[model samples]
Structures are given as structure tokens and as C-alpha cells.
Target chain A: MDINRLERVSDFQWKILPQGKMQVPAIIFASENLIKEMDDKVYEQVTNVAMLPGIVNASYAMPDAHWGYGFPIGGVAAFDPQQGGVISAGGVGFDISCGVRTLHTGLKPEQVIEVQDELANMLYYKIPAGVGSTGLINLNNHEMNEMLTGGARWAVEQGYGLFKDLERIEEQGCIEGAEPDQVSDHAKKRQKHEMGTLGSGNHYLEVQRVVEIFDHEIAQTFGIKLNDIKVSIHCGSRGLGHQIGTEFLKKMLVNAKEYGINLPDRELACAPIHSNLGKNYLGAMRAAINCALANREIVTHLTREAFEQIFPGIELKLLYDVSHNICKPEQHLINGVSQELYVHRKGATRAYGPGHPSLPQDFQNSGQPVLIGGTMDTASYILAGTRESMQLAYGSACHGAGRCMSRRQATRQWQGNKLIQELAHQGIQIRSPSPRGVAEEAPGAYKDVSTVVEAADQAGLARMVAKLEPMICIKG
Target chain B: MPQPRWEHFEHQADIGIRGYGTDPATAFEQAALALTGIVTGLELVKDSEMTEITCEETELELLFVDWLNALIYQMAIKKMLFSRFKINISNGILTALAWGENVDITRHQPAVEIKGATYTELGVFQTENEWVAQCVVDV
Candidate 1:
């Protein structure tokens, strides 16, 4: 966090030159003020990531970078398998593929306000949330494997959502190379009853209204307009992902020496990409990605059902769903040569630039929609990928307004009940199972999202399109 | 002699749990209690049911993580919140019995679902007469 330790490349770019065991340099994208506010651990973690074997280019930190296990929360790094690249479970994080999805309600804020209270209560009741909550549907062993392999496409087969929704999702709702057999029974059992349920801790479903638009052309492309009501769901693969991460991290740590990995930190445990252990972890981690896709699809279905009950014949169309925690194989130009590399995004979102072949046809000119989640009382932004982002940090951007304070500090500074009352006074209604959960996620606990977004925009990581404010939130 | 107890340390993003006891086994037990305490108050959970868990690792620090992760798995699958723990460590194996009741959302007011324990700041060490076990947990 000390500016003196880093060399300023520009107003929004700071660099840590490679030294000692570092194989590459470390770069952080943030404004001067934001950089000064970052925890010193970000410097340590990002440099530590640069030390990993076969890491390509520099280790990059997004504008919202914060201290996290192993890698910084908003960390991005690419590995070349041919160069002895390794895959790390810590890099992917415990909540595998944890991400955000935004939906268009096609209704104005006035229409939503007419039924806001009822809709809030209905969603809270219909959607399983909070600790110890279970969904109505349970998956047996056979169905569980099917879900793991099929992703949201599996959810559609089970009548959770429409088949057309796949196009808006990453990997068309189901990624390939997932071997269900690689996932342990313990992981599957933990997810059996957790499908369609929102687990607690910084996860939620919120109804928001578009308040500002930064780019009219991109906003129109994303189907955004001032005063339009939108619904966003934030969650991930739940218990299955957690178990897989826990098991694999331990395995990788125990086997690090065998893989010839010199770990600077135990939390950075990794294995060679071509090794059996790495293969097994990739297969299992991909399965968890599908599980997250399926979980979000089911929740989208429940949200649709809740909306239909309140406003008959309303259709909640998918805008875009993006995952922040993942290890994806992508092709990027390294020194003017296109090469395939495994890009690991921890608490960071992929921002594929315009004209990328993988993007949907409609978005070819506009680029991918980058959804940024905010606290219940803060404003969320919708950004578009820029061609510059592909070169900036492997086409990745900040995930959220990263936590600036610890939960314990947040609780001591503000009471949950009082915070809820204050938010209600400002016209934002909240429904949560636990007040303590609400307090820990208080808006004051996070850094200013606008500043972070501004930095990302200035750095060309992504270009902002629209900003939205919460109308009602159902916190998990 | 240090009394068996648990407390939370501050991490930038997640919570760090530390426990202190007269011996390593007791410290491990207290650490598990800290894990449960993250979800809900320990006083709210009842010791109505018991489950046995066992895990082995060559390293004490890894075994400590495995012990807590095993308890996390049990809580998720069994839908239970533990109030008390009994741990016995011999060689590299840890055998333990945890007692608690089924999760009651209304009664417990659980706050967060702990993902798992991480190796960050992980340790099992002795100071004077007290054994300390500590690590940061993903919530």
C-alpha cells in the first residue's frame, strides 16, 4: 500500500518490478487515492503470485483489489502449460465461480414501487436464503452427476428456466471438460439439498432501478434505460464448491514438493498443469463451475416465479451472467503471438473486448456486459468490455467494491437494526434472516464503488455504461 | 495454565479464529467452537445429538485444517450446529466427537455459512503452558 515501494507507470497504473523469486512483474490498476487505501497485503500477494511457475506476463490487480487468501481478492494471472504452468486451488478460491447475474424486468420503477413490499416479502419467502435453508428440490446421486455435467442446461431440462437463457450465460450455461467422477461423494452430498438456495455471507438478491447511464450507445445495447427496474442475483456453487476447494487445497499443499513447486506461501499451493492431481482438480473445479451455473439458473427461475405472481405476464429476461472466481483457458496475444493460457481470476470478472469471436452476435460491437455488484445501499454499475482490456489484464476487471473494513470492525461501528432503519429511511427496503449479517454487509464497510469504477474506466479495464441503485434487497 | 477458550482475530476480508488451551487437542476443540461461533452463538445451540469424526495428516498444521474442514462438512450435510467438542490427537490422527442440535433458523439467528478453513496465518504452536491453534476461515 506504500506508494514509495511501487513505481507509478501512470495515474491509474502502478508497477512492482520483478525481483528475488519473482518470475514476472506485478501491476495494480487503481487511482492514486484508491491505491493508497489498499492493504499492504495486496503488494505481498500480487508479488507472490508473480513467483508461480510458468506465469505469463505480469500479475495484475484490479481497482477493487483487497487482501485475500493466497492471491489478492481482485487478482489476475495467466499460466502457460507448455512452460510448466501450474493450477492452484487457492487461485480459484473456495466459492468457485461465485458471480453476479442481472435480469431485465421490462417494468418502470413506478410499476415496481406499486408492489415493492409485497414483491420483497414474496421473494424472501419463495427463494431459500440465509443459513440452514434448503430448496424444495433435492438431487439424488444420478441427478447430481447430471447437474454437475449439464450446468444451467440441466436446470432447463428440469423446468427451472427457458432454454433460450443459455445464450446470455458464460460457456452457454455449461462448460466442457467437467468430469463428475473427479468430484468426491462428500462434495456431492453437501450440494444435494443446497440447489436453488442462496448461502449466507455477502450474497443476496436485489431489485434495483437504473439511475444513470454513462454511455448511451452501450446502454441501449445492454437494454438499459433510466428508471427501468432490474433484478440481480449474487451467489455461487455453495457447499459443493467449498468442499472441493477445501479438499484440493490440502491435497495440493501436501503434494507441492512432489510437483517441484517451491511455495513462497502455503496458501499458494499448486501442481503442474499436466500432472494427474492438477487434471483431477481441473475436472472437479469445472464441475463446480457448472454447479454454480445451475444454481444461478434455478434461482433465476424462482425469481421469475415470484415476479409472475406479483405482476402477471411479466418476463424477466437475462442481461448477462458473469463469474468472478474461475480458472478459464483463454487465448490471448502474448508478444504479438496468440497463445492458449489458463487465466485465473480470483474475485475478478472477465471483460472480453469487442469483436471477440466467443461473444454473442448481438454483443460483437458492444462487447461483453460486465456486471458489478454493490452493497445493498450502494450503487451497482454495468460496464462494457474494451479492446484495451484484453491486453490490460487478460480481459479482466474488478468484481465488487472490495471490503475496506473487517466484519468485526463493521459490527462495532454500526448496529444492524439501526443500519436497516437508515436504509429504509433512504427508501431501500431490506429483508434478511439475521440482522448481524446485514450489519457485516453495511454499505459503509466497503470502499466507494464509483471511485473503483472510475479507475477501471480510466485504466481501460472496462467502460461504464449504466449505474443502478437498490430498491429492495433480500440478503442471504 | 491457560483456560480453553476461543476468540476472533481481524482479517481484511474474512474472519481469523484462534483458540488457546492447556494442550493441542483442547486447543483444536476450542478452534472448532470458534468455527461454530462464526455462524451463531454457541449458547444458542443444544448438545442433543453427537457425531464422530476422524482425519489424519502427517503435519499438525494440516491436520488442524482437516479437523475443522471435517467439522464444516458435517455441519453442512447434517444441518447441525455444534456446541461442544471432544478431541483426541495421537501421532498424526485426530478423532473427535461433536455434540449439537439441528439448525433452527428462528432460534439461532445464524449469520454466515463458513466455506472452509484456509492455511493463511495457520499455526499450531505452544507458548509457555498454552497451546494455540489459529487460521483464517472463508465465510
Candidate 2:
């Protein structure tokens, strides 16, 4: 990116003043080196997002910002309906509600290492993953509509998980305003056999060990300890979300002219929030969000079952579950007055600060747990929302180590078998259906995760709590 | 004349696919090949079964997206991998026949699942004697 085009606000902040058709300024949160390493498209996409209707405050990008389809990944923006605010399908991304969830497996690293190979194999055998993978449970039309509207809460009702797990999840595992009728039958058909399956490309189920603690108090609040075993599942709404996003992006583009909105990029197709098109998209999008929630909940159940097979009667408690790609109606202070705004976070996680009424009672003082995933061989970090983050980027933070190299480049540079062997030598075991998939997800293909987390911490987007390294990975 | 073929381009997070041919229909077919190539090796998939696909759009680029997305929908619902595509576009309506077999995980070693076709870098244009269709696909 061209540093000359931006005004340096701080060591970790850069600003682009509104110009041309831009309705608001563009702000990026990243360290100097991180900002310099960002693709030029990030600048173009962020600035393009600034020109959208009724965008509140400024267009903000997280520390891990990178070039994406429409809005830059790690982009954050809020809009007000009173000002002719618009809702964009591209702003939420194709993988709607794609996020990370961590679980506490009250066991030590040594205990896991004893049966590491067996456990990895069991997890691979039990959890449905990769292309064409289908779960044992198939949803009929009635069940599909119920699952779409009820979310994880419905999963628990179907004997997939415990009711208590809902408290740790965003929106208590079921987001309201999800109109299943708005979702197309074609979308529902795509998801019929896909429930609980981890869709491929950048999705995985990993067993990790906490290696270091950055903030002891916060770590304690999050129930973390050195050598403690944890499992993280990263996926989303699968085919249903993709269908919704694909169908809606085209619709938004066709109706953009009718709404009197000019699109700088066709991918940034949007409609007025108060319009019928926008309302229908929101209803359908929310249904996809619930699908993802239910998907993760069922996977959690499968993970627990796999663990019980190895360590009879072991308990795996839910830590926190939050989606990065979503648009939600949230309340925030604007000009010292609290108002509801529709916030879109594409590849950006919501980091609600301490004392927020939305948080679980246990985390009222410690803030929301912001889970950041890493590459198969890299270290993932646990961060907590900070009060300052609310004022920074609407309490938003980076989701992962944004890819620095393309998949083609990564595959050309590294062999999947060789990469797997290298990771195994480093005490990490990988179970993947395709060696080519492993090559595409090579650790070197992504930016250094720790650097991104450090930038987030320094920028006050989130406070680092603990760091974890992978012990085993079940790649999709 | 250069042979009709497909190639993959580099996008930061996703993959860009471009197809080249003497006409728009062939270019669209090659683009479908590129889309299938993203998931598995094209040669590994066999042309054992055929499915007809139809979609319409007034604009060329959107028609191209609809074409690819229709194939994606077929791949997901049918659990198939397509290696061959025959495209015919007339008056903004695309009617095509795609041939492939059910997904054989062990045989094909599929890499990723393509989510959808996006408008990013989307275009269908003519240059000199050949038509080129290109777009970035989320995988």
C-alpha cells in the first residue's frame, strides 16, 4: 500500500481523508510494518466502502486487513437507516457467520499426548469434513426450517449439545429476526445433508495446548492455564450461506439502479436498509447465521463424543463462540448519544468490552473472549475486548493471520506431504483428506499471526490473554 | 490459433479463473472447467453422467456468474465433479450440459469446496480474435 496516500494518526493507526464520492474517512488499525505489507487493494476496497450510503463514522479495517471480494477482509462499518443507510451482501462475505469456537478439555498436554495419534484418528473418523462430506443426521424440510430459525438452541433440543452451552455463544445460540421463509428452497436443499460438516478451504478442527499466558487474570477468567488442552473448530454455514450470498449479491446488483445507488464496484452491490429487498436479505442472512450456529453446536457434540471414546467421561466445556462474518443490529454511542446501527464485520470479530449487558455474567469484568485462529503450524492467541476498543473500531478486532500469498503460489512453493512431515516433526500431527489442501494452507502462505495479534493489542483493538500452539489438526 | 483452455490466477485470499476461446460459449465452457479444477484435478473426473443447466441474465458478466454458480449448485446438491461443459448462450439465456461423475474422494483427492462466483475481477470481453471470461471464485 502507498503510505503517501494516508495520514499517520499513530504508530498503529493510519487514516485516509474523505475524497471524491466518499461519505466518510477510512481508518486502518495496524502497526507500521503490517500496514506496509497490506495489499494495495485493501486501500482501494476500504476507500470504496467509504462511498456507500449512510456509512457511520468512518470505514475501519482491522490489523489483519487484506484484499477480499467486495469490502476488504477485516473491514468494519456501521450504517443508520434514518440516513438512508444501505445493507450490502458483499459486506458480510460469502461465508456468512464463519467464526471460531474454543472448548476447554480439562486435561493436561501430557494426558493428550499419551493418546494423540488415536485421538486424531478418531476425530477424523467421527467429524464430517472436506468436499462431499455428509453428516449422519439429514434434515427434512420441516427440520430444516426449524434448524434455520432455532439455531444451536434447536441442536440442543435434538440431543446434540447441552443447554448451558448457549450462554457462552453470541445471541445465546439463536439470533432473532431469522425468517426461514425468506431463504430459498434451493438454499435449503444444499444444506440438507451438510449439517455438522466442516466445509473445505481454511476450515479445520484443531487440538491445541496453551503454551503461554499474557494476562494471568484474564486468562483465569477465560479458564486458561499453561499446558491445558483445548480444541478449536473453525467453519461456517456451509452451502446454505454461499447460496444466500450468491443469490443476494446478484439481486442487489440488479436492483441497485432502482434504489438510486451508484456502485463503484459491482461486488459492492447494496440496497436501502428500509427497502423490501434489504429487509428480505437481512431475514435470509440471519437464517444462514443460525445455520452456522447449529452446525458448530453439532460439531461440538461430535468432538465431545470423540473425546469420551478416548478418556471416558471427560468433560469439554464451552469457552466462547463468536462469528466474524456477519451484520448485526447493535447499539453504540454516536456523538454522546446511544443509537442502534447495523454493523457489518467481514472477516472481523466483534470485541464487546467489559460490563456490556450482552456478555455472560462470568465475563462481565473480563470482557468478551476474542478467539483468533492461526495456521496449522502457527500459534493461535486468545484476546479479550478492551474498553478502548469500543471507541476505536466499534469494538472490532482481527480474526486470523490474513493470507499473504495466494493458494497457487503456496502450492507451487511447497509440497503438501513435505509440509505435513515438517509439522509432524514440530510435534503437530495433521490428518487431512487431500495433500493438495495442506499445501494451499502452508503456514508460510500467511502473515505472522503473532505480529498481527501484537498490532491488535498495541492498537487497543483487543488485549492479548493467552497463546496456544496446535497439537493436532483435522483439516478439511 | 491458440487452443481453448483455462488457467488459474492469483488472488490474495481466493482464486481467480480465466478462460480463453474463439467465442463466448467456448470461453464460458472453459471457465466452468477452471471452476471444477479448483476443487479437484480435471483429468481425474470422468464424464460418466450428464446434467442440463439453464440460467439467464441480460448482462454478459452476470450471465457468466450465474453459469458458474449454477454449476456450483449442481455440484453441491448432486455431489458430483464435472470435467466437461458444453455451453450455448443466446439472447442472454444460457443452456448447457455438464458431464462428470459422483465425487470419489479417494480417487480425486479434492482440495477445496468452491463457495460461489463473485463479481470481483468479473468480465467477459473480446480482444482481437478471442473472447475471454474471467472472475474470482471464493473457495
Candidate 3:
């Protein structure tokens, strides 16, 4: 982006003063080099978010900010209902509650090297993937309602996972106030067979090995160790979520005018928090969140089954599960007064600091374990939330190395079958539904993850802990 | 008369689909062709089955989003890839027929799955000689 438009706040902080319709300033956290690599659209979209009604503080962009619908992908904004805040479907993104969950594999890389192909193939066979991939667990009408309202807890009750896993997940695996009736039958029908499946495009389940540790103490608290093997699942609510977003965004689009909302960009279609439309969207959005939590939990079950078949007596414990795309009501202090606000994180993770009641009891002394996914070929990182970040970024952190190249461009430059052979040479095994999908997700298509994480740490958005390199990547 | 055509444009993150025709209805049809192009080559998907789609909106732009998303919803629920689209717009309502076959991984070889169409870069207008409809699709 053009540095000329922004004033440098610090080495890692850049600010754009309120202009035109902007109700507040726009701030970005990134290294100078990362900033330069960003598209100018980041400035436009971040400023657009700032212009939204009742946006608290500044419209902040994480280090991995990229141009996305409505708000930028790494955009973080909170709206206060008391201040006539608005709820935007576009801001939450199409993949509702799309997030990452890491599991402790308790095995070494060398141990898996011998059986890597088998493991990858088994996972590919077991985990339903791709555009229309569906799981074997079909949901009846009642079961569908239970899944929507119950979330991962419902899945666990159905023997998909253990009860012990819920505590480590956001909202204890289910967000309250999900109104199953608000979700459309079309959305539900699309999800009936899609439960537990990983949808296509930029989604994956990867086996990774911790290659480096930045903060030993924090890494220890997160149960991460150097050279330790971990499995990370990257996906979302799938067809149901997409249908909800599509339906709601269109609803909000035409209704925005009814609420007297003057949208600078049509994609930023939204309704005031107190509006009936807003309430319905929230109800449905929460249900989608639950669906995602449940889907990931079931996939975790499948992964554990795969692991058990290969390494008997192995345990895959949930380290932490956090959603990057969501809007949740959170309490934070503003000018010495604690107030509840709805925070929207699109391609941004919540990184609550230590001592926050939300953190699991084991992690109270530490912070929320923020899982940052890398591209298929790069090193992902684990970061711990800090009080500084909570205050600075509304408990938000960058989600991943944002895409630097368009999928179309990536496909033009690389071929999927060719790239797979090349990654195999580097000892990274890849399994997917389509080879063309693999080509579109070429590793170089994304920004350098470590650099983004380093910038996030330097900016006090999240403190880096450990780095993970993918040993096997199952793409969808 | 303008020939129906579809092309892809580069958005920073998502793919932009643009279509052109001599008339507004044909432009919408070509837009569907652009949406079809995102997954796989049109030749790979044949017109073996037909699905009907209808959308209603007061404005042209919102109707365009509704039309595409309705097709997306059907595609997901039906698990099909459409190759040919027959669209007609009257007043503000759109009724159409989309034809294609079931997904064959080996034959179709779809590159990526489109989640939904977005209002970003959305346009529906008549030019000096033809009509155009375009929008960005989330994949």
C-alpha cells in the first residue's frame, strides 16, 4: 500500500486518520516490507470498515490483511449495540466459523515417515472432501436441529468425540442463542450430507511437526514442544455456512435501504444490530458456528481413528480450537468501563490474554492458543495471546499468511500434478480431491507466514510460540 | 446483434466473471456461462439434465446476485455442474433453465468450488452496442 497515505505509529503500526465518511481512524499492524507487499485495496477496505456505524476504536487490519468482500480478510471491528452498531454478513464472511484446530499427535516425524503414504491415503479416503463431498453421518430433521443448536457437544454425544475436548474450544463447542428456525431449509438440506466434510478451496487437514520454538514458556503452556508432531484441521461450516452467507448478504443488501443504511460498497451490506433482520442473521450465523465446531470435532474423530489404526495406544488431545471468521459478543474495558460489544473477525483469530475467564483453566496462566495456518508448503506458527494484544487489537490476531496471488494466476503459473511431485521430493505428501485445486493453492501464492507472524508478534498482536512444517497436507 | 461470451477478470482475492451479449437477457445467460467456467471447461460438462431456477428482486443488481446464488444453491444440493443456461428476465423476476450433468471427478476436473456470488464488482447495464453483467464470485 501507499505509505504516503498513512502515518507510522511505530515500527509495526501504521495509521490512517479519519477521512470522509470514516467515523474513526484505520490502523494496520505489519512490517514495512509486508505493508509494501499489500495491495492498495487494503487501505480502501479498511477505511470502509472505519466508516461503518458504531465501530469501536479504529478499524484495525492484521499483518496478513488482504482484499476481501466487505471488510478486508484480516479486518477486525467491533460494533456496540448501545451505539447503534450494525451487524454485517459480509464482514463475517461466507465460510461461517471457518477456523483451525490443532491436535497433539504424540508422535515424532521419523516414526510417521515410513507410513506417511498410507496415513495420507487413509485420511483422504476417510475424510469426505471437495465441492460436493458428504459424510456418512446423515442428519434427520430432529438431528439437524440438534446439530445446529448443540454444535460440537452434539457431535460428542453421538460418539464423534470425547467430552474432554469441548473445554478447549471456543464457546465450549457451542454458542448460545442459535435459532435453528432461522436457518433456511435449503441451507439445511445442503448440509445434511455435508456434515463432517471438508469443503473445497483453501481448506485442508495437515500433519505438521514443530520445527522451532520462539517462546519456550508459552509453547510449554500450549502443550507444544520442539520437534513434536501435531495435526491441524483447516475448514469451516461448509455448504450450510456458504448458503447462509449468500442468503443473508442478499437479504441485508436490499434491506439496508429500509434501515436507512447508506452502503459505500454494496458488498458491505448490513443492518443495524437492533433490526429484526440483524437479529435473524445472528441467530442463523450462530447455528453455522455450531455446525463448524461439530464438523471439526467429527473430523478430529476420523483423524484419531486413522491414527489409532497406525499407532495403537496413541492419544490425540485437543490443544485448542479457534474460529477466525465469526462475530461474537465479548466484554472488554473501554476507558475504564467494562462493556459488552460484538466483535467481527474475518480472517482474524481471537487472541484473548492470560487471566481472562474464557481461557481454559490449564491455560489461564498463559493465553488463548492462537493457531496460525501456513500455506501447504510453508511453516505455520502457534502464538499466545497477550494483554497487550487484547488492548491493542480487541483480542484479535492475524489468521494466516494471506493469499498474495489469485487462484486463477496461481493455476496459470503452476500445475497441480507437477507441484505434487515436487512437494513429494521435499518429503511433504499431499492428497486432495482435485489436482487442479492443488495447483490453485500453490504455496508461493501466499505471503510468507513466518514474516506475518513475526510482524504480529512485533506489533504485540500475538506473541509467537512455535513454528510447524507440514509433513502431510490433505487439501480439498 | 452481439454474440454471447464469457471471460474471467482478476480481482485481488476472488475471481471476477464478466459476460456480454446483444441484449440484457442474453448477457445474464452469458454470465451463467462465466460462472460455469470457474469450475471446469464447458465442453467437459454436457447438457444431460436440466434444472429450473427463478429469482425475484426489485433492482437489476440484486436480481443478478439472487439469480446466480439460486443456481449455486441448486448446484450444491443437486451435486451437479451446469454447462448451458437459458435465462429470461421479465419485469424484475428471472426464470431460467440450467442444463449439465452430475459431477465426474475424472472427466470434469473442476479446479475450485465456488461458494457464492458476491456484490463486489457487480454490474448489469447496457452499453452502446450490447449489454453486460458481471460480478465477483467467492470460491
Candidate 4:
């Protein structure tokens, strides 16, 4: 597929002109090299998104953008309700708030190398993962209701995490206006025994070491010194989130005719934002967000307990928790006035700049920490959000190195066992219950994350602080 | 002759099901049947509660996804299960009605959790005399 037709905005920015049926242009933030590597069809999908109702600015594709259900996985777009904006289930993805959270460990990698295997096993066993995996924390309706409203704050109150951890979370760990009733009974059933468990497919609990520090001051402020060991958790609201997304998408599709919305793609199926369908979807989606926050917080507690057993008095401080799939209400300076806009970020992360009132007091001087996850063998980076992000892409940035090939293609190209051995030879310990799962997520499946993160930084979207390499990976 | 079992496709940590039949109608029916098989065992759902469900899709492939996804939704949100479905596909138009019973979760168990139908590999193609569509669902 020829991908060179894109017009370059800068070294790391590109745009595609409006084509047939396109209501607006499509914007892509990637280096020339990254753009060349992208599938040419991405241009078509981006343009298709431009035609959706309530779409704002330019439909955006991050450096890691790839063809997904409707919008590209790393796509970001906002719709104006006053101007007939619509909400889509395809836009937010099945895993609502499927996100990444990073925790800072007081101990360095060198201090824990001897017990790496034990630690990895403990994490693997402690965190229930893989398909059909059941979790330890089972909650009734009343408890689940509290979790939906309280998020990580409720977990902290239950002694699951430090009170300070709540401040570092997105939406302060609780999204407002979450109506538990909006969530279906099946969604609740799915969440019953799934809380505190890490669901499968690209989800992982990794022990990493800070190998590089680009911004020394910011890294120091985050307590991320060179060689310091850290833990990263990547997962989300599990079955409950999936149920809510599915239920809403069907409702939206059925109601699309009423809104007079003709979709460019059925997957981008939507209803007008001001309509009843849109309001109900937002409420249900927010509830899933709360469920995700509470779920991740519980996982953090398990990690903390595991660490305490190993180091006795060591503390696991949270760096930040950010959801990748979501639609949120935010105040952005548009036309020099702070306007309340609804931002739909699918497989993207929100990177609020320093001094953004949403940040915790401690990070007021340093922007929100953007956790960019990489493959088990690659290095993940800690980035700080930039003011330019708010102006360019609704304070959003690439979530990770999006997939370059489908998992089936990857499985055909590489052997899971051999890949594990190769990584082990390279000094990265990997553990997972399913070997097919490992093969399906081979590094070759994804684009080069370093290149993606570099483009975001060079584009002035975010600034890099520290780089983390895996010491031991507990893959789901 | 025995019809071939549906072909399953995996797309980046998600699952997709594909099947081709002698015609579009049969393909649509098979797709629905296969999707129901994936989410839970269809044998347990009695045909006694056969209810009329009519839906229209612009294309057969999308209609198949819409039909199965709708059934899955009914099963999940409403605790209903289906044993049979009457589907029709004509000139890119699809209409289907399913039959199922109210499920008692305490009595029957679930086999898998299907997240939603994804646009991944979602397309309709013609194979000589038959119409074929492929879709990847986030399971």
C-alpha cells in the first residue's frame, strides 16, 4: 500500500485532505518514517471518521495509529453536542478504560535480581489472568455500587492503597455521574468475581528498571532515579466494561435512524450527543470507568502486599494511573476561552500539562506522567504532558506501539516458545500461562514504540522523562 | 453432504468466526449459529421460547454481526438464550428472527464472554455463487 501521499505538516506531523464523503480533514502525528510504515488504508479510515456526526477539529491518528474497528486504535476525536455530535461504541472500544498504571518501587533492579523469578511467579499467581480466569475479590451489588462511585478512593478507604495514590489517578479515580442502574445485570454478573484480576490479551504485570533519564529534574521529582525498580500494571474493567460497551453500541445502532445519522462506517455507529441515547451511554461509560478504576486499585493492593512480603518495609508509591479508552468532559482553551468539550480517546492517553488543575499538588509543577508501555523486550518510557498537547490533540498522545501485524499473522511468523527463549537469552524473564498468548503478542506484531514516543516528544505533544526496561515480565 | 465447520480467525488478541455456504441465507444462519456456539452452548437453550426478532442491515455481513451481537446482547442484558433463528438475506438486505428462552443463570453456566463485534477484518465478499462476509469480535 502506498502511504507517501500524505502531506507533511512538520518532521512529526502529517495531514490527509478531505476526500469523498469527508466532512473534515484527517490529521496524523507521526514522523515521515512512521507514516511510510503505516498501512495506506489508515487514510481511508481517518477520512471515514471525519464524516461522523459531531466530529471536531480533524480526526487524529497518533504515531502508533493502526486500523481498528471504526476509528484507528490510536485515534482521537471530539464532537460538539450543540452542533450534532454523536457517541459511538466503536469509538471507545470493547474494553472500556483499558489502561496502564505505573508504580515506583524504592528498591533498585540490582537489589532484586536474585529474587526475580520468585517475584514474577508470585505476581503471576496472585494476579488472575488469561481467558476465563476467575478472581479472588467477589463483591455483591451493594459493594459493586460503592466501587462504581468511589473508584480508587473506595479502595484506599478499604486499605487497598495509600491515600496519596488517589491524587495521581485520572478523574481522581472516580468519574462523576456514574449511574449503576445504567449498567445491565449481565455487566454486573461479569464483574462479580473479576475485580482485582488482570484479564488476558496484552495485559501484563511487569517489574521494570529505569535505565535512562532524559529529564533529570522531572525524573528526580517522580522518584525515578536510574536503575530504580518499578512495577507496571496494564488491564481494565474486564467483562463489566465489555458488557456496557456492547449493550450501548447495540442501542446506539438501533437508535441511529432516529437521530438521522448516516454512518460512514457501521462500526462508527452513533447517536446524537444531546439525545437520550448519548446521555445514557455517557453515564454507563462513566460507570465502567469507575469500575475500571476500582479494579486497578485493588490490583495495586495485591502488588503492594506481594512487595511487602519480599522487602518487609518497602513502599510502592504510585506514579500515575491513566485510562486509554474513554470519552470524557474536559475544559480546553478553544478560541482563547475554556470550553467544555467531550473528548473521545480510543486507545489513546490523556496527557494533561503541568499546572493543569486536574493534576495532584505534588505534580502541579510537573505535568501528568504519560506511561508508554512497550513489548516485554523493549523499553517503556515515562513522559510528561505538554501544553502543546492541549492545543494539538485534546491533551492526548499515543498509548503504545500499536500493532503492525494481526496476531494471526504474528503467530504464523514466529513461534511463542522460541520467542520466549530468545527473550530469556537476552536477559528478560517472561512468564505466562498460555504460550499461544505469548506468540500472539510477539514484539514484531507492534510498531517501534521508541519511534512513536519520539515523534510525540519531537512534535511537542509530550516530553520524555525516564526510560524503563523489563527485569521480569508477567504476561497475561 | 455435511457443511464445513466455520473457520475461526484471530486478530491481535481477539477472535473472529467465518463461514461460507451454498448461498447468502445459509451463510447468515451459520454465522449466527456459530456466534451462539462461541458465547455459550446453544443446546441448553430450548426452542420453546422462540420469539420473533426482525432487523434490517444494509449488507449481509454487517447484518450477520448485528444479528449475532443483538442475540448476545439479549442473552447478556436480558438473560435470554436462543435455540433457533429464521434469517433471510436478499440483495444486500438482511432480516432475522430468533427463538430462545429466559435463562436461569443459577441453573445454566456460561462458557465464554464475548466483548463486542469489532470492525477488524469486517468485510463482505462474493465467492462464485455464494456471498461471504468476515468479522472479528473482541471476545
Ranking by DockQ: 2, 1, 3, 4
Inter-residue clash pairs, candidate 3: none
Interface RMSD of each: 0.6, 0.5, 1.1, 6.1
lDDT of 1 by residue, A1-476 (tens): 88999999999999999999999999999999999999999999999999999999999999999999999999999999999999999999999999999999999988888888899999999999988999888999999999999999999999999898999999999999999999999999999999999889889999999999999999999999989999999999999999999999999998999988999889998898999999999999999999999999999999999999999999999999999999988999999999999999999999999999989888999999999998899999999999999999999999999999998898889888898899989989999988888988889999999999999999999999999999999998
Candidate maximizing lDDT: 2
TM-score of chain B of 3: 0.97
Ranking by lDDT: 2, 1, 3, 4
TM-score head-to-head 2 vs 3, winner: 2
**lDDT per prediction?**
0.94, 0.95, 0.92, 0.79
Task: Report the TM-score for the A-chain of model 3.
Answer: 0.99
Worst 10 residues of 1 chain A by lDDT: A408-417
lDDT (Cα, tens digit) per residue for candidate 3, span A14-100 = 999998999999999999999999999999999999998889998999999999998999999999999989999999989999999
Stretches off by above 4 angstroms in model 1 are none
Residue-by-residue lDDT tens digits, candidate 4, B3-55: 62455675544567776666666666666666665544567667776655455
TM-score of chain A of 1: 0.99
Best by DockQ: 2
Q: Write the number of the candidate with greater DockQ, choosing between 2 and 4.
A: 2
Model 3 misplaced stretches (Cα beyond 4 Å): none
